[model samples]
Target: MELRNRSAFHEYFFETTYVAGIVLVGTEVKSLRAGKVSFNDAYCQFHKGELYVKNLHISDYAFGTTQRHEPTQERKLLLKKKELRKLEAKIKEKGYTIVPLKIFFNDRNLAKIEIGLGKGKKLYDKRETIKKRDVERDLKRYVK
Candidate 1:
């Protein structure tokens, strides 16, 4: 199953995207398969030369035992060293953020996340996007 953050497009303009592996406990993985995950407040942060994701909530498994993982924990993200360095440099600038766009299990059954380098949209930018979308919708409807 794939979980997507639809609001990402409305909230920010994505510059580049990369897929990264997420470190999850057994319970977390099980929960993800059941579609018990939320990206409402999750964001990627660079910490001590490594990248970590915070506020990514993976609900506890229904059949979890006493070792259930916390719902909201800082999960480490695995990315290549060169990519990490590149992201680090870009993020150090103002207004750029690393945001999770989606989460899905790859072919090998491992959880992977799609992250984007984004800059938040201003009020006018958001309004412009809305207007553009409205025009596109009208055009599509007329074509049909």
Candidate 2:
């Protein structure tokens, strides 16, 4: 299956449970099925005791006209109340965030989003991650 967006492992220090859900809107859902979505720079926020994803871009359906939904509008995330509370607690900690790891469809033909509770990485941390990946790649190439 094709994944819409994948969070960088090095950039995210931690990950929690994976949840699945359906997204609202007609044109938005159609656009998502077409893989016309981007999760980069997108994150979740708690508003009025509910979770909403912000900055996520779901391109307007090609056939949709001016009535099409906004590309960067906040999208609601469906999760149980218990899960929402847990996420809210975790987010209260310093430097913690919720990021969308991937968006895909399951066998039942429903759209699902995989979200991760993540911690931001510093500049040097990201550089180190790149360096380690390069070393691993070189080792694998040399082993052949």
On lDDT, the leading prediction is 1
- Overall local distance difference test of candidate 1: 0.93
What local lDDT does model 2 show for residue 53?
85
Angstrom error of the Cα, residue 20, model 1: value is 0.3
Q: What are the TM-scores, per candidate, against the unseen true structure?
A: 0.95, 0.89
Q: Taking the tens digit of each residue's C-alpha lDDT, what string does model 2 give over 1-144?
A: 556454556677766856758466768878887888887788889999989889988888999866689899888899998899999999999888888878877888778888889888999988998899899999999999
State each model's C-alpha RMSD to the native. 1.1, 1.9
Question: What does candidate 2 score in Cα RMSD to the true structure?
Answer: 1.9
Clashing pairs in 2: none
Off by over 4 Å in 1: none
Clash totals for all candidate models: 0, 0
- Candidate 2 wrongly placed segments (more than 4 Å): 4-7, 65-67
lDDT of each: 0.93, 0.82
The total of clashing pairs for model 2 equals 0
